[model samples]
Target chain A: MSDFIVGTCLFMCPEKERWMREREGLLHTFEVDEKTKHLKRPKADPSKIVKCFSRPAAGQLMPDTSELRPASVLLSTIRYLFTNVVTRVDYDWVMIYDFVFDRLRAIRQEVVIQRIRGPQSVQILEPIVRFHVYAGQRLCEKNISVFDTKINSQHLLECLKQLLVLYDELEEQSSMCNPNFEENIERLSIGNNRPQMEALYMLLHLGDSSALGRGISLPHKYRGKNVKLAMKISLAWFLKNYVRTLRLIQKLPLLLKFGVLSNLRLLRRDTFQIMSAAYNSKLLTFPGLKLQEILMYRDVEKLSADCKLFNLSFAYENVQFDARKFNKGLLLANPDMYFTVQTLQKYLPIILLQDDDAINDDSSS
Target chain B: MDSYIMQLRRAWLNQDGDVLADLLSLSHNHATNPQLGSDAAMTKAMEHLSAPFDDLVLHHIKVISSLNKDDALTSYAHQSAAIQSLAKILQLQKDENWMLPVMNSMCLDLRRLALKAEASKFGKNQKSGEVLEKCAECLMSCFRVCAADNRNSEDDTKRWGMLALVNQLWKVYFRINKLDLCKPLIRIIESSGLKDQFALAQKITYKFFMGRKAIFDSDYTAADEYLTYAFVRCHKESAKNKRLILTYLVPVKMLLGYMPKKSLLEKYNLLEFWELVEAVKRGNLRSLEEVMNKHEIFFISAGIYLIVEKLKLITYRNLFKKVYLVLNTHQIPVASLLAALEMHGVDDVDMDETECLVANLIYEGKIRGYISHQHKKLVISKQNPFPQLSSLNSN
Candidate 1:
């Protein structure tokens, strides 16, 4: 808090600029805090500008609501597809996912093309987001090791985005119209799984600013215990407090655990990179068991294999961390599962139905 | 009511923005009989004004009459209708900003009435900020017409009005906590060519909000640049405005290693930060937590809680530097640093987590050298190992 410290970054100070110029500081000049700095166009990077701002004008071809398919019919069609395709048979989930995914995409496209923003759009998107998480975990637990299908959780992110847009529009519409606002999810038998969606959002986007904002914006009275825990785990994740992240992930219910499971590669990669520096040595061995435990790998052998994969050395069972030997080329460590094939099979329906006993879980912080 | 119609006709006919602003203002005291909105009276009033503009004038009159009747919901509806007509008229007028004053007034009044209506019992079932959110959409209607009027000559472009609209929209967006929407509008403005040409007041307003947004994005360089512009060039007499700007600027400056003067905080009555500055300098984590909890409402309401939490990294740097200074060696033990943190009340911290902290500091370039795990010590550069955080970004 010294004046010299304050003077060092006093960007607006006339005296500082004059003093720097007098010192002939030509090479390390301060950024010009010109009034027009923001006004000036970005000289090099144009990608920051959104391309969709060039909106189309309304024309006679703009369709009326009467001619389009009702949101109810579209909602039912998606529901039918989900029931018959996704959950009808447990095996071949990988193929069922492709079929259900194609059908769901077309249905959502139909909703967008038809401009559906009623409570029905809410009904349709609520299930679709959950479907992605359930189906994604199912793919992760597949007997085959396909990184491509396992990383297909982007679709869940997309649906979550779609649901956020629908919720905003629905809010505006409810205010625009006085009494008929049915903010209900029960008429069609799909209860508001909004709490589950929030949990998924926190898990999937753990440490993301938008996700963190969603968590912080909610008062404790408004959010459920599940949401509160999800927020805490994500906050720990954000801070790169890997130790706490490891500890908190142990307490999460399985549904929320899928979030940690979703972020496993990132968790492992981050842990290894930091540990390479923290435990950096040519001879000292950071325990392989501790790394396996914190990262939730199935076993230490797999953990050791990943250490080699990331250019770190594994000695016997302990990891020898040399900062120079750490590889920065690979961003993610090898993919690993938190569940065995049998455990995932037993829990697939439970996760899909969101019937994870974790829903009632009130684990202490 | 008769004089109201006369002035409305004159303003609409002559296209006088100032006159129209008063005639449509929410506080303009157009206290007329409620019967003016009845079918027969609306027809009589409509006979005098022209098409399109007639709807605008008539709706404003209806809005005022409803306000007089103490029926805010009805007043808000009529004001919304009035803004809808105003947007059509703004689009209809080609290549002139003579009507911009009215646009500004109507949009501002539209927000006032919306907030008033939201505060009333009629909004009991509505979610907080919904009315204001809808009001932002109404403002967007004007915004689209103005932003899309890019084909006009610079002297006559309605695009000049964009900053004012954007400033209002930013206010509503921040109020409703839908900051995500402000990004596109910011993109349009920053990407637009009319950046410097807006009136000075509007430019100041734009920079002030943009600076706050940058803080949220953690782009401190941009935050410092934009916010310093707003704080310096902001009107000399506007102490309240300067204090508002300082609320954000202080944290950004601190993060960049430029601590604000205590007198400056005292002058602005922002000494809530004085305790924080002291805690950070003394490397007192417990006192830092106490100051934060004592002013928790202030910090959270100002939306700087998370940014303040980020200062903990800086606190750790300061704390470790203290240990290094006392020990006077390049190879200070990690356990010594952990004990220092524990002495300063960093509860539940351990060697591994402390190492994680040290790793983050080095990674962030607060420290020059690296951690030597085999030696159980931090390896220093033997040069300017702990570089001043501010000098790290001067270029």
Candidate 2:
């Protein structure tokens, strides 16, 4: 289940049409029955649905698609049902709901849903996306948060560009993936992979345009079908550029903001610990003291208990003295006095013992 | 007269208390004895005794007071001296408590004569600063004798008496700013028992450190709160742990204004980590922990503890579980975990399993789970919110 959620997070839509089609199949099961006359409930087929989508992922991702009206409508409807519906829906039903909701958002099909439901229902979907993002962020932060920095630096750029392309492809392919009243029967492939990098590049260029203070310009060739493909090509350009790739990721302001950093709670401590260790290793080899490493366990009581077992001999003991004089430069005169005293206390006795026998022999001679 | 003075000095050097006493008695006796009293004899004896007797009495009193235990003859010797000689010694050693009763008698007559002289000299309704100044001078002279002779005085009683005298002098001196005169007195107290003097010094030092006008002038609220808080704790026993506190506090004080900046925070974090590493290399956990706790950098503290344990300077039994849990929750790297664990001689364990356990533990600290030893495997079970089955399934 964890792997699947992570995998879904990593996938870019439109290019991954099979994932979108699978989402449609899941959504089809949740559609209101026409023949039932609003009287009887429709039966849900458990086996046909993806196991990964069987449970409701608490904080699902939703995006704004103002220009892609049809895709936005479908997204908004699924968003309402999953996030706002508030039924005692089983996990399988909820997963199916997310699959459809996310697919609709990805394909930009909200316009058709808006025209179908009119403005009021579609307007409500906007808040649902906003609210769920907040809710998910809160939930995730309350638990352990980790950021995977394992991906090679080179691949990082490509990953970001692909994500943007996936966003645009979802907007373009909404109708083909969405259930239509006029279609007699159709089976859409929902398990094949497509290179969705270009569409993401277009999203980056589009997002960056406003950020850079450039007015939005739709290319002359980007009309209808050509528009979606043009978006794909632009996303590919974004994927190819490493510097802009980060910017593209940065452009997805919703997911990649400072708030995203909160998800990387461990990153802060881990970074500290690693750097500390590296520095200590260099220091320990440099000269005199052989200082021990310190592990600060989270539990205070446990840390205290561990401290009790610390060997006083192995861990060097240092004595401190404070001589206060209000005048200037008093500290510099005997600055190393405490260090000298502690070191002397530690090693001087042994040296003294070694000299004692020699001194006695010289006196006898 | 010179021959008589030389004779008195010889007697004092010989410690012939009786001979010195006879000479003092003879002077007063000649003052009243009508038959034996003569102007020439009285003047000769007073001149001879006055100068040598004053030095001799003061020196003997000092020697006596320096004795660690009470001597049987201390009270007897004070009574035998003529009031003139006694007055000179008592007035000079104003801080001495042992001479209080005898000094009081001499001071009565001397004070009366001084009051009469002052009335005649300064006229009526003088502001009395001069008179108070004279009294303070007398009081300070007495305290010096007592302090110089303090070696014999018991530590506690001597300290209390000295504190009372110094307090009196301090009040008077603050009005006049003649603090330099008290330098010898302060040194005397320092020599007797320096360790016991910190509380006294701390009270004054804190006032000096906090009462600086700059902090009050700028009105930086955080600086005010922090500096004030520090000033209060500055006198604590732990405050005597200066080296440990300063390592963290110096940096903390510098960064107080700069901390709100993200770039500054990043730099501070790096600096703090480097400092901890330096402390670790020095093999001084107290210094390391002091910095860590003062800053409330629990993760750094835990990291250092792990490092110490790995170095064979400490063991990693009870604490490893908890620290591992915290770091794990932070999604600290597996390689980092492996490195930390290996430093503690836990290198024999399977790296893969250990990494998973550590990762789970970090997550567990965040999730508020139980990361404890159960059946010899480190378990990271989530708390009640996630449902028992979910945890069981994860396991």
Candidate 3:
């Protein structure tokens, strides 16, 4: 925590060819700091771009949730999440909060899919995970998932209702940097925080007691002692939703090209701070949350070095190491890969950690 | 009762390590005696030993033993830490820990007896031909011991033995040619209980034939028949075992040069094979290599090799040296080689690389006294492949 220079590479660097030109015919430039390398911020006015940028034709969401009208709302939330949160800030720096929020939004999509359907819903996990997997270039035409069964329409509608409320909270949380944003907006009524919190608690319980739900289990490994897989899953979901919302706002070119807008960076930065505060509250209750903490914690310098090293090992068999170490190192190196690692790391500890404290506590106490 | 077994079978087949570990511990607790428990439970557990599940079972058994001296299984929960401490006590490295014990158990008795007998024969200066015959007999007996263990079904034992031998030969091949190292092995497996005629030997022979022909030219149709028969029987087993089949069956399927039907692949969630191949194509070397090592199925690696070749994901020139190296050392059948080479980067330079590989193989064969180099071509006589060699040279 001292003055340890965290080695890192920012997504924006001077040499990177700016794909889009700004006003005054100037290209967005990333500067190599004395320590950190290649950091570039996206457009300054992300909202202006959001307002102007054209939407894809409505038919494109098909073979997925295209049949549901609420699907468009979720898609809009998705676009908003990317442009507002992810693309707004030059997330090329290893900021802990951005990583948390972005990963949260990605997780939210899974819930959204489930809400749009149900446990018995049409292939929930695949399309949801594939949304990001394809974004990360790890997907191809052959991808398939087993959990794609359809659900009752009523169940789907209920999930969609909850998701819409969650989306409203997310959008408000992400677009807060807009100075025009009032504390109490006339048209938008946010879902009560109590219900949001309650839904989370219920989902966590369902995770523990139910067998058919999202592969959650409370084996003897981490059964008691302190860690709750249910809570961790919920927190992970919340943060992923928040980050995806912010990303949607930032990535939209509508704000950046034309309009006067609030400082998007402030919204991103503040949302992350809020997430960290909430996470810290949970940490007091569950010390074992260190699994996710380690992921959020970054040594920028170490990561930068890891990214380069991992990239090289990609093509050579002589490179010796497991995929996890190489991937962790690569994630560290590339700040832009924050959302990617957070989403992956979210499930791993819950699935893999076999702490004996839970069982031991039962016997001793 | 069958339905109940099916559910337990599902948990086992899922390679649900945690669940299986729990079940194993429960079974051990119910067991009244430790030694009897270990051996008896292992025998009964054959139906539950799918590929990865088998590995987890072995790991759990070791973990249990390391914890309690008197009741490894029953006292599992009590001795988890002590078991971990035992790992340190044994100075067990990750790679060495899981594989070594199983290999040792399978090979130790044979290895020691073989060594002692050879030493005795040499001390009196017995005839060399007599020594060789004695060596062959000893090796055959070793395979039979593996083929006949009462702890598991004969098929499981034989399958276990074939896997052990393949692993052993892979370790040995770097220093010795396959012909020299596995000569006795080839003889034993060819006629031993692992023949296609044997029921338990079905899967073992399928794998044995695949490995045998993997590096040389010969009749693999019979080998394919054995494997296909094994494939039909695979449905009776667990998902973990099905995953195991992909290690070999996938390569065989590819050698047959067609994607397997959806039903077979679905049962195993075997798309990971295609993903690994895609990673290989995209130059994701780490993932590709990890999949090969994790899967530990030579046929899968060979299948990957074929896919890499077919798609031109790799250049033949770059892989020529390694292909040459593998060909020179192993007397795998030509068809197997073509199947293996079919998925690698040998397309544009196919003729040249094939010639180089063939020449290297021929030279090595001549040195091993298995073939003669005449008129700039190799002639096979009294070698491993026998009748298949005449047509192999042209291939």
Summarize candidate 2's per-residue lDDT along B21-93 as a digit string, tens digits.
Answer: 5543312232133322234534454555556355534433322232212322322233223334554554444
* Per-structure clash totals for the candidates: 0, 60, 74
Candidate 1 chain A lowest-lDDT run of ten: A45-54
lDDT of 2: 0.33
How far off is each candidate at the interface, as Cα RMSD in Å?
4.8, 29.6, 37.7
Instruction: Name the candidate that leads on DockQ.
Output: 1
lDDT of 1 by residue, B1-395 (tens): 56667777888779787987877776566545565555665666788877987888778768867776788878888888988988888888887878898889888888888888877844355555778888999999999999999888888889888899999998988888788999889899989998887888889989999998898777889999999999999998999999999999999999899888999999999999999999998888989989988997798788887778778878989999999999999988999999999999887888767777887777667887677655667887799989999988764
Poorly placed runs, candidate 3 (over 4 Å): A1-365, B1-67, B70-182, B192-197, B201-226, B273-395
Docking class of 2: incorrect
Worst 10 residues of 3 chain A by lDDT: A254-263
DockQ of each: 0.13, 0.00, 0.00
Per-residue alpha-carbon lDDT of candidate 3 for residues A283-320, written as tens digits (9 for 90 to 100): 12212122122223123343234324543221221212
Task: Return model 1's CA RMSD, one decimal.
Answer: 18.2
Please identify model 2 stretches exceeding 4 Å from their true place: A1-365, B1-338, B343-371, B374-395
Instruction: Please give the lDDT score at residue A121 for candidate 3.
Output: 20
The worst-scoring run of ten residues by lDDT in candidate 2 chain B lies at B308-317
Candidate 3 residue-wise lDDT, B1-395, digit = tens = 23323444676445343443334342335223345235444444456555444443444444444333543222332222222332232232222222223333323322333333434443242332332343333334434445444354443343344445433343333212233555555566566554555435334434544543442332334444545655557666566754664555554444333345556666777765675444443434445546645654442333333322222222221233244346664333444344445564223323223333443333322112121111222223334421222233323
Which candidate order results from sorting by lDDT in descending order? 1, 3, 2
